[model samples]
Target: MNNPKFEIFKAKNGEFYFRFKAGNGKIIIISEGYVGKPSCVNGIDSVKRNAPNDNRYERTDKTDDYRFNLKAENGQVIARSSEGYTTKVNRENAIDVVKKEAPNAPTEDQTV
Candidate 1:
Protein backbone atom coordinates (compact mmCIF):
# COMPACT_ATOMS: atom_id res chain seq x y z
CA MET A 1 0.00 0.00 0.00
CA ASN A 2 1.15 3.55 -0.68
CA ASN A 3 2.09 5.71 2.27
CA PRO A 4 1.66 9.45 2.68
CA LYS A 5 4.53 11.60 1.42
CA PHE A 6 5.75 15.16 0.84
CA GLU A 7 6.52 16.40 -2.65
CA ILE A 8 8.66 19.48 -3.23
CA PHE A 9 8.36 21.41 -6.42
CA LYS A 10 9.06 24.78 -8.01
CA ALA A 11 6.19 26.97 -9.06
CA LYS A 12 5.89 28.79 -12.38
CA ASN A 13 6.93 31.97 -10.65
CA GLY A 14 10.17 30.18 -9.61
CA GLU A 15 9.25 29.90 -5.98
CA PHE A 16 9.67 26.66 -4.09
CA TYR A 17 6.88 24.90 -2.22
CA PHE A 18 6.10 21.52 -0.76
CA ARG A 19 2.85 19.62 -0.43
CA PHE A 20 1.83 16.71 1.74
CA LYS A 21 -0.19 14.07 -0.02
CA ALA A 22 -2.17 11.19 1.35
CA GLY A 23 -1.60 7.60 0.29
CA ASN A 24 -4.45 8.10 -2.16
CA GLY A 25 -2.50 10.99 -3.78
CA LYS A 26 -4.72 13.80 -2.59
CA ILE A 27 -2.88 16.92 -1.46
CA ILE A 28 -3.90 17.59 2.11
CA ILE A 29 -1.55 20.43 3.05
CA ILE A 30 0.68 22.87 1.20
CA SER A 31 3.41 25.27 2.21
CA GLU A 32 3.69 28.94 1.35
CA GLY A 33 6.06 29.94 -1.42
CA TYR A 34 9.70 30.37 -0.54
CA VAL A 35 12.50 32.13 -2.35
CA GLY A 36 14.75 29.10 -2.21
CA LYS A 37 14.69 25.35 -1.85
CA PRO A 38 16.45 25.45 1.52
CA SER A 39 13.70 27.54 3.05
CA CYS A 40 11.09 25.30 1.48
CA VAL A 41 12.83 22.25 2.94
CA ASN A 42 12.88 23.94 6.31
CA GLY A 43 9.16 24.48 6.03
CA ILE A 44 8.73 20.77 5.38
CA ASP A 45 10.81 20.02 8.45
CA SER A 46 8.61 22.34 10.46
CA VAL A 47 5.54 20.50 9.27
CA LYS A 48 6.99 17.18 10.36
CA ARG A 49 7.97 18.65 13.69
CA ASN A 50 4.60 20.25 14.38
CA ALA A 51 2.16 17.88 12.76
CA PRO A 52 2.02 15.62 15.79
CA ASN A 53 1.03 18.40 18.12
CA ASP A 54 -2.67 19.13 18.10
CA ASN A 55 -2.08 22.52 19.68
CA ARG A 56 -0.07 23.66 16.70
CA TYR A 57 -3.04 23.56 14.39
CA GLU A 58 -5.04 26.76 13.93
CA ARG A 59 -8.60 26.22 12.81
CA THR A 60 -10.54 28.80 10.88
CA ASP A 61 -14.19 29.03 10.01
CA LYS A 62 -14.81 30.86 6.76
CA THR A 63 -18.15 31.98 5.42
CA ASP A 64 -18.37 29.07 3.02
CA ASP A 65 -15.91 26.54 4.44
CA TYR A 66 -13.73 25.37 7.29
CA ARG A 67 -9.94 25.58 6.99
CA PHE A 68 -6.79 25.12 9.04
CA ASN A 69 -3.16 26.12 9.25
CA LEU A 70 -0.31 24.20 10.84
CA LYS A 71 2.05 26.54 12.63
CA ALA A 72 5.52 26.46 14.05
CA GLU A 73 6.38 27.26 17.64
CA ASN A 74 7.05 30.86 16.66
CA GLY A 75 3.50 31.26 15.32
CA GLN A 76 4.56 31.22 11.70
CA VAL A 77 2.34 29.13 9.47
CA ILE A 78 4.37 26.29 8.06
CA ALA A 79 1.59 24.92 5.94
CA ARG A 80 -2.14 25.06 5.37
CA SER A 81 -4.97 22.89 4.15
CA SER A 82 -4.92 22.71 0.38
CA GLU A 83 -8.67 23.10 0.22
CA GLY A 84 -11.29 24.16 2.69
CA TYR A 85 -13.57 21.40 3.96
CA THR A 86 -17.29 21.65 3.45
CA THR A 87 -17.98 20.82 7.07
CA LYS A 88 -16.21 21.50 10.35
CA VAL A 89 -16.23 17.75 11.02
CA ASN A 90 -14.41 17.15 7.77
CA ARG A 91 -11.83 19.78 8.62
CA GLU A 92 -11.24 18.23 12.02
CA ASN A 93 -10.93 14.79 10.45
CA ALA A 94 -8.30 16.09 8.06
CA ILE A 95 -6.43 17.61 10.95
CA ASP A 96 -6.51 14.24 12.72
CA VAL A 97 -5.13 12.57 9.61
CA VAL A 98 -2.25 15.03 9.41
CA LYS A 99 -1.48 14.56 13.08
CA LYS A 100 -1.29 10.84 12.48
CA GLU A 101 0.52 10.71 9.15
CA ALA A 102 2.80 13.75 8.69
CA PRO A 103 5.55 13.06 11.18
CA ASN A 104 7.09 10.17 9.26
CA ALA A 105 6.04 10.83 5.71
CA PRO A 106 8.99 10.57 3.33
CA THR A 107 10.04 13.53 1.16
CA GLU A 108 10.28 13.37 -2.61
CA ASP A 109 12.12 16.25 -4.31
CA GLN A 110 10.34 16.78 -7.59
CA THR A 111 12.10 20.05 -8.32
CA VAL A 112 14.87 18.43 -10.25
Candidate 2:
Protein backbone atom coordinates (compact mmCIF):
# COMPACT_ATOMS: atom_id res chain seq x y z
CA MET A 1 0.00 0.00 0.00
CA ASN A 2 1.18 3.50 -0.74
CA ASN A 3 1.62 5.77 2.28
CA PRO A 4 -0.63 8.79 1.91
CA LYS A 5 0.54 12.39 2.38
CA PHE A 6 -0.83 15.87 2.96
CA GLU A 7 0.36 18.61 0.65
CA ILE A 8 0.02 22.21 1.80
CA PHE A 9 0.05 25.14 -0.56
CA LYS A 10 -0.81 28.79 -0.90
CA ALA A 11 -3.62 29.65 -3.24
CA LYS A 12 -3.38 32.36 -5.88
CA ASN A 13 -5.44 34.53 -3.56
CA GLY A 14 -2.77 33.92 -0.89
CA GLU A 15 -4.86 31.73 1.37
CA PHE A 16 -3.53 28.44 2.62
CA TYR A 17 -5.12 25.08 1.82
CA PHE A 18 -4.22 21.42 1.80
CA ARG A 19 -4.97 18.22 -0.09
CA PHE A 20 -4.66 14.69 1.12
CA LYS A 21 -3.02 12.38 -1.42
CA ALA A 22 -2.97 8.64 -1.65
CA GLY A 23 0.35 6.84 -1.86
CA ASN A 24 -0.02 6.97 -5.60
CA GLY A 25 -0.20 10.78 -5.38
CA LYS A 26 -3.91 10.81 -6.16
CA ILE A 27 -5.69 13.46 -4.13
CA ILE A 28 -8.39 12.04 -1.92
CA ILE A 29 -9.58 15.17 -0.14
CA ILE A 30 -9.29 18.91 -0.35
CA SER A 31 -9.68 21.43 2.48
CA GLU A 32 -11.17 24.87 2.48
CA GLY A 33 -8.84 27.83 2.37
CA TYR A 34 -7.68 29.40 5.62
CA VAL A 35 -6.61 32.98 6.08
CA GLY A 36 -3.43 31.89 7.88
CA LYS A 37 -1.03 29.00 7.57
CA PRO A 38 -1.52 27.99 11.19
CA SER A 39 -5.25 27.75 10.67
CA CYS A 40 -4.66 25.52 7.67
CA VAL A 41 -2.35 23.32 9.71
CA ASN A 42 -4.95 23.11 12.43
CA GLY A 43 -7.45 22.01 9.82
CA ILE A 44 -5.09 19.22 8.82
CA ASP A 45 -4.73 18.21 12.44
CA SER A 46 -8.48 18.25 12.85
CA VAL A 47 -8.88 15.91 9.91
CA LYS A 48 -6.28 13.53 11.27
CA ARG A 49 -7.97 13.40 14.65
CA ASN A 50 -11.55 13.30 13.42
CA ALA A 51 -11.47 11.21 10.25
CA PRO A 52 -11.35 8.00 12.24
CA ASN A 53 -14.64 8.68 13.90
CA ASP A 54 -17.82 7.82 12.01
CA ASN A 55 -19.81 10.43 13.95
CA ARG A 56 -17.58 13.21 12.70
CA TYR A 57 -18.68 12.73 9.10
CA GLU A 58 -21.63 14.61 7.71
CA ARG A 59 -23.09 12.87 4.69
CA THR A 60 -24.82 14.77 1.97
CA ASP A 61 -26.34 14.10 -1.39
CA LYS A 62 -25.61 16.31 -4.35
CA THR A 63 -27.63 15.57 -7.47
CA ASP A 64 -27.23 11.84 -7.87
CA ASP A 65 -23.92 11.47 -6.08
CA TYR A 66 -22.99 11.17 -2.41
CA ARG A 67 -20.21 12.97 -0.53
CA PHE A 68 -19.11 13.55 3.02
CA ASN A 69 -17.57 16.31 5.07
CA LEU A 70 -15.17 15.56 7.85
CA LYS A 71 -15.89 17.90 10.71
CA ALA A 72 -13.97 18.93 13.80
CA GLU A 73 -15.18 18.42 17.34
CA ASN A 74 -16.58 21.93 17.25
CA GLY A 75 -18.70 20.97 14.20
CA GLN A 76 -16.67 22.96 11.73
CA VAL A 77 -15.99 21.26 8.40
CA ILE A 78 -12.29 20.50 8.15
CA ALA A 79 -12.00 18.65 4.86
CA ARG A 80 -14.16 17.07 2.20
CA SER A 81 -13.94 14.04 -0.05
CA SER A 82 -12.48 14.93 -3.43
CA GLU A 83 -15.05 13.18 -5.58
CA GLY A 84 -18.64 12.17 -5.14
CA TYR A 85 -19.23 8.49 -4.62
CA THR A 86 -21.80 6.62 -6.65
CA THR A 87 -23.20 4.74 -3.68
CA LYS A 88 -23.61 5.35 0.03
CA VAL A 89 -21.56 2.25 0.79
CA ASN A 90 -18.76 3.55 -1.38
CA ARG A 91 -18.87 6.92 0.33
CA GLU A 92 -18.71 5.36 3.79
CA ASN A 93 -15.87 3.09 2.72
CA ALA A 94 -13.98 6.07 1.39
CA ILE A 95 -14.31 7.73 4.80
CA ASP A 96 -13.05 4.58 6.50
CA VAL A 97 -10.05 4.56 4.21
CA VAL A 98 -9.30 8.19 4.99
CA LYS A 99 -9.49 7.40 8.68
CA LYS A 100 -6.94 4.66 8.20
CA GLU A 101 -4.61 6.70 6.00
CA ALA A 102 -4.54 10.22 7.45
CA PRO A 103 -2.90 9.59 10.85
CA ASN A 104 0.25 8.11 9.36
CA ALA A 105 0.37 10.44 6.38
CA PRO A 106 3.36 12.74 6.22
CA THR A 107 3.13 16.43 5.48
CA GLU A 108 4.72 18.15 2.48
CA ASP A 109 4.89 21.91 2.60
CA GLN A 110 4.42 23.22 -0.93
CA THR A 111 3.64 26.76 0.15
CA VAL A 112 6.88 28.24 -1.14
lDDT of each: 0.93, 0.88
- 1-112 per-residue lDDT for model 2 (tens digits): 5679999999899899999987767777899999999998888888888888889989998776999988889998889989998998888877877889998788889976
- List CA RMSD, all candidates: 1.0, 1.5
Q: Who wins the TM-score comparison?
A: 1
Candidate 1 per-residue lDDT, tens place, 15-104, comes to: 999999988788999999999999999999999999999999999998779999999999999999999999999999899889989999
Every model's TM-score: 0.95, 0.90
Question: lDDT, candidate 1, residue 86?
Answer: 93
lDDT of 1 at 38: 95
How far out, in Å, is residue 65 in model 2?
0.8
Alpha-carbon shift of residue 38 in model 2 (angstroms) = 1.2
